[model samples]
Target: MLRRTFSLLAAASVLALTACGSGSPSSTGGTAQGGAAGGGDLTKVSVGVIPIVDCAPVYLGNKLGFFKDEGLQLDIQTATGGAAIVPGVVSGSFDFAFSNLISVMVARDKGLDLKFVANGASTTGEKGKDVGGVVVPAGSPIKSAKDLAGKTVSVNNLSNIGDTSIKSAIEKDGGDPSSVKFVEVAFPDAPAAIANKQVDAAWILEPFMSKALADGGTVVSWNFVDVSPKLDIAGYFTKADTIMNKPELTQKFTRAMNKSLEYAQAHPQEVRDIVGTYTKIDEAARSKMTLTHWTVTFDKDAFKTLGDAAAKYGTLSKAPNAGDLLP
Candidate 1:
């Protein structure tokens, strides 16, 4: 959510470097030829990811050898938020990355060539029981989304999906969406921010959302569900040229990623188990956290609705072209 000016400069510089250095294979070591399950030379891929419940499938997929089955050796990198991940992908630091749909759209809006290759995570679409929601301190007067007007709300990102969907929910509840102020507070820190009265409400995700509730925080809105019931929240994405020049690589990644999604969905306990390996989330929080819906397909209609809301809320200059962005 914190997009520094230098990140854009770094992106441009790295793009040029990647173009010049691409002819030679990267020095990063991978499984030897015929070492993979599919018996071919393994492509060493670097992936940027955020350490959160939404990204559990990718970690699970790697653990289950799905990537190896596709002849890939993944070198997964963790960033704090999409702010770094988006720029990393654009600059070619990552062969692929996981990010929310709105961040991808914002990158595209900025003339960065990025595309969603596979589904990452979606909302369960069940109010008060979804993976994430807006929470206020217990006994706070802000009892509903409408009451959020003129209050300071904390989101991980200011203009990305969090605030965009929240604004939609506020307007739907007859609140003046523009009247609310949004601040950037990372999910890990948001619970404390709310507790200390630093913000009127914080839109948080698991396992922090579950922790906030356990600590007596109150849920006010399931923002994603309020925006659209079938919303696809995030996905695996890569540079446009990666799709064009290395079609086979992208195809293989998509297949492996899809497999991971399906496996995670089928094995919810495994998803919780895998989450602990990458993130600092403890076992108890992992078990109690709400799991996001995982799938191989994108809900284009839901995405369009989210995009339109983003545009209306000034997150984007205009809604992104789904045909161009979606795989």
Candidate 2:
């Protein structure tokens, strides 16, 4: 299966502008613990999310009335990258946000008080499955990871899983990892770029991964599995203050989200049915895409392995303790 933690490296630069923006929850003032099955004053919250297949649970929860069942109204905000979303969450415009562990750790390393509320996505650990892949034009001379040397690869972001995973895959195959060049292209735009030979290979995720393959993009490697066998890639997170000031709201939200996650894992077709509603991928494409492993708990050891890899690749200055990072 494919595992991805790609980045739009420039997002870090946009954090300043995002931090200054403020937004309030849509509805307020019921009780300290309001009418939700749990007890919380706040029943409305805005969530920051990217339009990707990984966000199935959030969309599923909203559409199936899971959030409403728990007495919460979810206001969904779509953004291109986490850089824009993270600041919104930090500034209170978003009560919670979906983000990759790398971006969250980068923010935490810079002193953002964040906590994982639920696990959003993980890899299937099936080596050649539909998780993530580095694809080239059909019948290209590039046959293995070693052939990637001195070639340009397209990733959704820089200094992220796209680059790190690709590099690891290349090195494992005896290629000069440092010789590879990486460029940033949005996931939707990557297939066209690769087909046109703009980049030698494109780091692609599901739904799109299936589309790229249909478009004659040849799979060169699965970058993520080579990085680690089982990985917890991304999750939903909120500020510590949200947890402290609105304990019941947080609990209710978590419960609803956990229920949605369980539903997503158990019902892939149902999850795929709603992916297009929240994202650009259509029903046809959604039917072809591979779903991610969903969970509510962030496994401590899995995160540490990812963190250590990030530090080794210079994504982080030092490896962070998983316990200190999680709530």
Candidate 3:
């Protein structure tokens, strides 16, 4: 029931973005503009984005006319998970995507020529306030990471941030991460999954993290900061083909995105408002929810930590060299 309610609200937000027209692209632009090919007019690009707080910059950028001023029209495509959006990016259905740094790594490993156009969101290890956590039901026997062994846990993505971060945390807590079975469950559905005992715990993020806690989910650990004190969690990226063939457009996107990032950092309430506009998160929850730190600067240290965690958790086939990954 809660999940259904969330879906309805998300649909309304998408309609709101569409109806606003100034920030988001006109829904009628597809046939009129000839399907993101503009023919020397404003360049139209389809952007794949997960409907999460980390994507605040893209929504804010659209709302603020940053992308419009850059001579671009964004066709926003919402997806439930970053992995689910990879095919669209690879097939050119989505020119760019708002995705986690870890998801980008997985795509690159699978031979997708993804490149970073701009940094998305990062964290300074604010445990109670940041967007990552390991959560269990209120009365679950799991009280710490060590208790997670020989149990099933849920992640929004299998080989991405949730699994890697939780594994690292478990290892640090003297537990065998490999012994824990990881499953994929969308964040929106995770709280109910926990409430029904479908999964023993969930590695989730806000606003789902807060929702889960509100639904009698206890915090096993919200220590993603301990995994990487300063973390670059998400980024805006596109295919290598786009960057090479459309250098000017890519640079323009970076500039506009950076401007939006600056604005998001400077205006938390405004960011929250934008988030509420595109998500089912209520205004009250929006005010209380911890927002992701918007950043244009990529953190090499955080990337290294993520790479190391992936390698240690057996997600990466080989150790990642930053040069090969970042563009």
TM-score of each candidate structure, all chains considered together: 0.91, 0.85, 0.84
Candidate 2 ranges beyond 4 A from true positions: 1-42
lDDT of 2 by residue, 1-327 (tens): 112232323443454345322343343213224545565544667778887888888898888889888777777777766667776676565678888888788777767788888788888777778478899998789998989999999888887767877887888899988888888888889889988899898999987788789998888888777667677788888888778888888888889989989999999988888886767777777777778888777778767877887787777788888876675
lDDT tens per residue, model 1, 1-327: 434233665754654364322332233233445545556678788777888888889899888899988878777877766777787777676788898898888888888888999999999989978999999998899999999999999998678889999999999999999999999898989999999999999999988998889889999999999999899999999888889988888898899999999999999999988888887889988888899999899999999999999899888899888998999
Better of 1 and 2 by lDDT: 1
Off by over 4 Å in 3: 1-40
Candidate 2 lDDT for residue 164: 72
Cα lDDT computed for each candidate against the true fold? 0.85, 0.77, 0.75
Clashes in each model (backbone N, CA, C under 3 Å)? Answer: 0, 7, 0
Residues forming the 10-long window of minimal summed lDDT in candidate 3: 1-10
- Winner on lDDT between 2 and 3 is 2
